[model samples]
Target: MALVELGRFNRNEAHILIGRLDSEGVVAIPFDGEASIGDGSYLFIAVRVLVDEDDLATAKAIVESAA
Candidate 1:
């Protein structure tokens, strides 16, 4: 399954969305979260939320509704 981007968000927000997706049975992950750390400018960097291509639509809806 190819991973596709759902959206970009701050680390905390990405984690929250991951939890939301988890609760909804969608497997989502945040990329660049660790890379954003150690610079103290982590907030300036956006972490990407990725999900399986097949789950893209459902994950998008869940994210949109939470917005």
Candidate 2:
């Protein structure tokens, strides 16, 4: 299945959201989470949260409700 972006957030927030999604049975991952580490600006870089394309709608609902 193709991976699609759910949203972009800082590393911590992305991981939090991943955990939330996981609890709801949706598999998610962070993209570009380490790119900013090299420049010491990780907090300012936006990490993308990705999910399976088929799970996009459900993931969106879970994230939105949690917000």
Candidate 3:
């Protein structure tokens, strides 16, 4: 399955979004989340939220609605 970036968020925000998507049956993963741990500058780094390309539209709608 091809993955596409749905949005960029901080680590915590990414987790929240992941949970939100999960509730809607959309599988999303946060990239760079681990790498940002312990540096204490994680908030400065943008975490990438990715989902299957086929689910892009639905995921986008979910994220937009949350916003």
lDDT tens digits, residue span 1-67, model 1: 9999999998889999999999999999889887756878777788999999999999999988987
The per-residue C-alpha lDDT of model 2 at residue 27 equals 96
| Candidate models: Cα lDDT each | 0.91, 0.92, 0.90
Against the hidden reference, what TM-scores do the models get? 0.90, 0.94, 0.88
Q: Identify the leading candidate in terms of TM-score.
A: 2
Best by lDDT: 2
Candidate 3: tens digits of C-alpha lDDT, residues 22-61: 9999999889877766978767888999999999999999
Cα displacement (angstroms), candidate 3, residue 6, comes to: 0.5
List runs of model 2 lying over 4 Å from the truth: none
Tell me the alpha-carbon RMSD of every candidate: 1.1, 0.8, 1.3
In terms of TM-score, how similar is model 1 to the real structure? Answer: 0.90
Model 1 residue 23 lDDT score? 98
Off by over 4 Å in 1: none
